[model samples]
Target: MRLALAQINPLVGDLAGNGERILAACRQAASRGADLVLTPELSLWGYPPRDLLLQPTRLTRQQEVLEAMVQELARTMPELALLVGIAEPKGGGQLPNLFNAVALVEAAGWRVVARKLLLPTYDVFDEQRYFLPGDAAAVLELERRGQRWRLGLTICEDLWVEEELQGHRLAGPDPVAALLPSRVDLLLNLSASPFGQAKVPLRHALARRAARRLNCPVVYVNQVGGNDELVFDGASFVVEACGELACQLACCTEDLKTWSPGRHPAPGPPADAVLPEPLEQLFRALVLGVRDYAGKCGFQRALLGLSGGIDSALVAVIATAALGAEQVRALLMPSPWSSSGATDDALALAGRLGLITHTLPITGLMAGFDTALTPALGQPPSGLTAENLQSRIRGTLLMAVANQQGRLLLSTGNKSELAVGYCTLYGDMNGGLAVIGDVYKTSVFTLAAWLDSPAALPCRRSLGLPERGELIGAAIRHKPPSAELRPDQRDTDSLPDYGELDPLLRALVEERRSQRELVAEGTDPELAERVSTLLRRAEFKRRQAPPVLKVSGHAFDSGWRMPIAAG
Candidate 1:
């Protein structure tokens, strides 16, 4: 039987939009003469419906939409068998829990034949808060093209059999392992997996091992698009029974794939060109994430303050790539101490990329703040207080534009700066979303190098635009990185060089190492102590920081929450 895996992107509460997307995929598959189609988990109401599931009426509305989708499928494509996911309500002292269920659609109607047996509750997942465990195995018996196929259905956490071998299986029985005894010919798993820096490799290995062990072809469909701060990279695939890859879907997109049981019965390297660098992959994902977030949040344009520095420059590149030049706007908000070269760079980059640029000097805004504070202090301040005032002025101007024009304000701050509490809280930190908040300073430099090189950069998905040579001009790369909040300032003045600081931060923040442990790993005792102190004191600041995409195993979210006095 010809099977189609629809790697789709769905909105959280757009029930009609989600159903329409599923139907469109089924129609496309049927046109290609495929007998069956599969979509991502929770395609009906979108994954992680969160509190939307709390509304009793919302679930009823979802049910109505599902019934309508079934009727449409029965009338329009009777020969195609479509498997889609939704929240199934259980009865009899079930505490009104929802199930990650798969509904089989055919000419007769729809039946939720399989339910997920596992619920994950680690890191970012809080499934235990909403869903109850399903005790029954998910096995579906269907006939397609006069062939009887017993296909096992698994949700995102259902096919997590690797845990059993590793002794980490805590949620439920291994869903894939349970299928081996059923003598199934094929297995299908649906997922809404979140994106992480090193998650793709682990995903491939998981699917390959499962397919090899079951000795049956497995189709994996993953959800794509940005939901809040979580970006889902949909690099879905079809693996053959013997672990050969038959087909692969596009990354960071909504893609469709068709595969047959016996044809090319093994998964292979992804058909699409591999992302050349971690930065390129990350860039593409970030651009897509921002684009989808703004679009889905009902905003058409985004505005950010351009400080003529690398962080804002990189953010502009991502914004232009994601939302296009016309949809993004940048303002050069310079203070008296702001360098001429910074403004030159900002205008030159904007001109080269064809983005709308504006200038808003903070001289008047600074005067206003100083006047308001002069009453109690009797004089304008100097040093860190004055520097922060400039930042706050720029931030206030950006927010004004965002409020007036209905644009989403994008904050331009990197993880390195955020880690050390180098940024001004209400000043530069005022924005709706943090773009490169997950990226380190060294990684930013690497990304700049790749964007300038002719070769494809690592971690970037396609920008869907013509290449403009190197993204970051050579001068920007060669210049020393600085926030420019103070006069004649360089980053190294307040902190260690990026080369020294990034590794230590990675070890301490991402690896969760103690000061002693970091020092034992060859980190200087002085630097280690300083880094630990900064990380601790910054807890209050991080708590108020905007939502950032989690691209690493350890992101600065609840996933990596540290007590204020942990040190």
Candidate 2:
């Protein structure tokens, strides 16, 4: 049997659009002589539809969309069958009325084919909150070329039977192990797994492990495109019985590829030309993330304060690459204490990127704030309050520009600052989206160096950025990171050096390390305690901060859930 794996990008709640996407894929598959087409998990409603799932008209709309798709497929490609991921309403009277489901639609009509067993609640998955798990495994009898074939079907989390993923245990029924009794010839897993650093290897390992366990070839199809903070990298692939990769699709984009039961894939590492280097992958993910977020949120222009710091510089480059340089506007909100080099560096980076820069000096605004607050406070605002005042002024000005120009304001704070209470609330944390808020400060420097490296020039030029030496330049890279709120202000004064700080942050935030674990790993006990304390204290601020673009194993928003007032 020939299978068409459809990796499509869909808008959440766009039922008609999503159905059309599936029908179109099926038509194309039929044109290419494929017997059946498989789409990503929740392809019809789009994955993680969030509160959209709770709408009263959801089931009605779903029925209407499915009927439309079946009719369209019957009219357009009568012979082709489509396996589409959909939300099946299991009826009301329970807290959850849905099952994460897939339906098989052909010329006759559509019926729920397979229901997901495991409802993952960890990290970005909140499936258990909205879905009731299926009690039994599914094995379908598919026919092609007048021959019978047995196929096992599973959803995203059902395939994640890994005992340990980065030491995080996902306790669930082993879908592959259960499928052994079903005696399926081929296994199909539909996923909407988002991108993370070194995540591909883990995903590949899981697929290989599953195929090895089942002793049958596995077909995996994942959703592609940026949906809010999550960027689904659809590098869907097929692994043969012996766990050798037979077929693979493209990553970070909409792709469709075909495979047959017995035919070996084109060999040679499943097209390395499209699978980018890790640095390049991160860059591309951020670019796609920004582009999709802006467009989806109905913004044509993106604006950010260019502080001449590394965070702002990196974000500017990404924004320029995502939206054209013509659409990305920069504001250099220099304060009284802002160094001349900082101003110069911001201008130089903006010039290199060909972005329109507006030099909005905040000196007058700073003095105005001081005068207005002096009477209320009985004295001039100084120290932390003074520093925050500067940030708030810049934030206000940036908001003004964003509002006037109708540009989405991009927040430039990195994960390190956000980890601790180093950022000013309603200040530097202001924006529509926090681009690198999930990226560690150490990783920020590493990415900057990678961007300047010769390997990045090709991807850079292709993205329409400067193809020459040092797109970020040396000054921005070498400069000590500062908020420039006061004289000679350095981030190190408040927080540890990024080299020392980032590891602890990752271990604590991403790895979920303990005080004992940190000490065992040779981390200073006091430093560990201090950093952990800061992380907890900053929860309220993070709750109020803009949504962060998740690139690491764990990010602040949906994944990192903590009670604000709890001990």
Candidate 3:
């Protein structure tokens, strides 16, 4: 039997729209003569539908759409089978009253074929809040061409059972191990897994382990696109029983492919199976995140404050690539403290990227704010207050322009600044979407350097970026990082050097390590304590920041739920 993996992008809460998307993919799969079609987890309402699952009306609408899909399939392709993810209602007076489930739709009708056993509650996933676990493993037997095939069905977290591979395991039955007794011909996992650094390899390793254990080829399909803060990288693939890759789909984009279990291996890599370099993968993920976030939110254009620093430059490059240079607008808000060379660099970078830029000097705005607030403050704002005024002025201007143009405002702050309270609350942090808030300051430098290097030409061309030399320019990439809020200002003046700070922040934020642990590992005691204090103190500021496009395993988005009143 031939199986078609539909790596699709679904809009959350749009039940009718998502149903149409599924039908469209089914048509494409039917044209390729697929015996069965598999979509990503929660393909109906999209993954992490969150509070949308709580609405009774949407649940009713889901049932209507499923029935409509059944009728449409019966009228069109009467012989093909389709597996679609959905939230199945279980009316037994349970709190959640639903199961994260898959429905097998055929010409006759549809039925709940498999329910998810594992409900992940960690990080961005809150499945336990809305779904109850299925009690048993699901096995579907189908006859095609007078031959019966047994397939084991699993949802996103069901296949994530290996503790050694996943670092930690959820408290649930082993879905892969349970399938061993069924002697199934194939194993299928539908996932809505988000993109993280090097997560693609981890997913492949997990699927390979499942394939080896089940002694059957495993097919994995993932959701692609940015849903709020989460960006799903749909690098779907088929793994042979011997832990070898059979076929792979594209990353960070919608894709569909059909594969037969016993097809002979082709020479070299499988078609579309080669993964891009790590840096390229990251860049592509960011571009997709920005594009989908803006597009899904009804914004055709994006606007950002274009400082001459690395963070804004990197955001500019990503925004240009995501929405095309014409759709991305940059406003250069130069203050009295802003250097001429920095302005020059910003203009040059904009020219190279073919971005539309308007220089909005905030020197007058700063003076007006100083005069207006002098009475309330007893004197003109000075020192940190003065510095923040410049940022707030620029932020207000960016927001006004974005509001006037109906554009999505992209925030340009980095992870290091956000972690250390180096960012102002409503000033530099103003945006609808934080493009690189999860990226460390050092990673920002690396991304900028890569964008300028000759190695990025092919990917740049693919992303609609200029193929010419030095898109970011050496002057911008090599310059010392600064906010330009004060005279000769440098990020290092207020925070530790990024080279030393990023590793510590990674340990503390991502690994959940403590100050004592860092000191035990030979870190300076004072630095460790200071960094910890700053991180905790910045909780209030991060609480109000925009939805950050999550690239790392840990981000300051929905997953990081720290209290403002925490000690």
Candidate 4:
């Protein structure tokens, strides 16, 4: 059978819109003579519909949409069959009376063909709270040309059962193993997995393992687009049982491809099987995150404070690429402490990117704040208070511009600073989205350098970035990391050098390593203790920060739920 994998971008909670999107893909698949079409998990309502699943009206509307799809298919293409992911209501008195399900829609009608066996509760997922896990593996038998084919169906987390490969395993039924007795001809996994460092390779490894065990070719279809803080990279592919890639789709964008199981030789990776370089993948992911976040939130433009620091410079580049230079505006809020060289670099970088910039100096605003607060404080704000006052002034100005212009303010703080409470609350932390709050300061430098290098030309062109020369410019790329909130201030003055700090932060935040363990692993004893204390102390600030576009495995977003009052 010719199977078409629909890698689509769905808006969350838009049942009618998502249904239309699915029908469009079905039409494309039908034109290609595909007998069957597959969409990602929760394709109808998008992944992690969250509390939208709780509303009775949406549930009723879901049935209406599904029936409408059935009629449209019967009227248009009677011979084609499609698998659509949905939330199937289970009647009775159970609390979570719904199953994360897949409905097979043909000319006759639709039926729930497969229910997700694994309900992942970790990370950004909380499927267990809304879904009742299925008890058995699902096999859909199809008869085409008088020949019966048994196809195994698994949802996103069902195929993520390889503990050794994934380093950790969710405790549940092994969906892949359950399919062994059925002797299925093909294994299909419908997923909405988010993009993370090396996640594509891990998915490949899991699928390859399942293919070998089930002794059948595996087709993986994933949802693409940024939904809130999560960005899905639709690098879908088909893998042969012999552990060779048969076909691969595009990354960080919507795609559709059809492939028959035994069409090609199982010798080597296909031309499209080669993944993009790691940096390219990362860059594309961030761009997609920003684009979808702003677009979904009804923002036509984005605003950010460009202080000539590496963090803001990198954010400016990403915002320009995501929304176009015309849609991205930079506010250069310089203070008395701001250096002329730094301001010059910010302007130069903006020129290269063709970004609209407004230099709103805050020196006068700083003076006004001091005068207004001296009576209440009995003394003018000084030291750290003075530095933070500058940041708050710039943030207020940026917010006012964003409010007046109806633009989304993008926060430019890095993960390293957020981890240590180095960022000011309601100051630099103000934004609609944290574009790089999940990225380390060191990674910011790396990304900036890569943007300037020649290797990024193709990706740059794809994103509508300037491909001829350096986009970020060398002056900003090589500048020392600073906030420019105080005179002669450097990031290292408050925190450890990022070269030494990022590794520790990674271990503490991502790996969940203890302070004792860090010291045991040869980290400086006092440094580890200090970093750990700071990480804990920063929980309240992180809790109040903007929704960070999550790129790493562990981000200070919905997943990091540390108690604000805890020691």
- In terms of lDDT, the best-performing candidate is 4
Off by over 4 Å in 3: none
Question: Model 1, poorest ten-residue lDDT window?
Answer: 457-466
What TM-score would each prediction reach against the true structure?
Answer: 0.94, 0.97, 0.99, 0.99
Tens digit per residue, CA lDDT, model 3, 333-386? 888889999999989889988888999888888888889999999999999999
Runs with alpha carbons beyond 4 Å of true place in candidate 4: none
Q: How well is each residue in 82-155 modelled by candidate 2, as lDDT tens digits?
A: 89998898876997889899899888999998999989888888987888988889888988898898989999
Q: Which pairs of residues collide in model 2?
A: none
The TM-score-based order of candidates, best leading, equals: 4, 3, 2, 1
Residue ranges of candidate 1 with Cα displaced over 4 Å: 92-96, 163-171, 265-277, 457-466, 563-567
Give candidate 4's error at residue 490 in angstroms.
1.1
Residue 273 Cα positional deviation in candidate 4, in Å, after optimal superposition:
1.6
| Global lDDT of model 4 | 0.92
Question: lDDT of all the models against the reference?
Answer: 0.81, 0.88, 0.92, 0.92
User: Tens digit of lDDT per residue, candidate 1, span 1-567?
Assistant: 999989899999888899899999998998898898999988888877877877788788887887888789778987888888888887566554787788887778788888877887776777777777778778888877787999888888877668644345554477778888888888888999888776666677788888888888778899999888888988888777777666778778788878888765324454563533455557768887898889989988999887777788888888888888898899998777788998898888887677889998877888888889888888876778988888888888889899999999998888888888888899788898999888998888888777777665333335644375656677677788777877889989988898988888888887777899888878789989998787778888888888877777677765766766563
- Give per-residue CA lDDT, model 4, range 55-157, as digits (tens): 9899999999999999999999899999999999998887899999999998899999999999999989998899999989999999865678999999999
TM-score of 4: 0.99
Rank the candidate models, highest lDDT first: 4, 3, 2, 1
**Global Cα lDDT for candidate 3:** 0.92
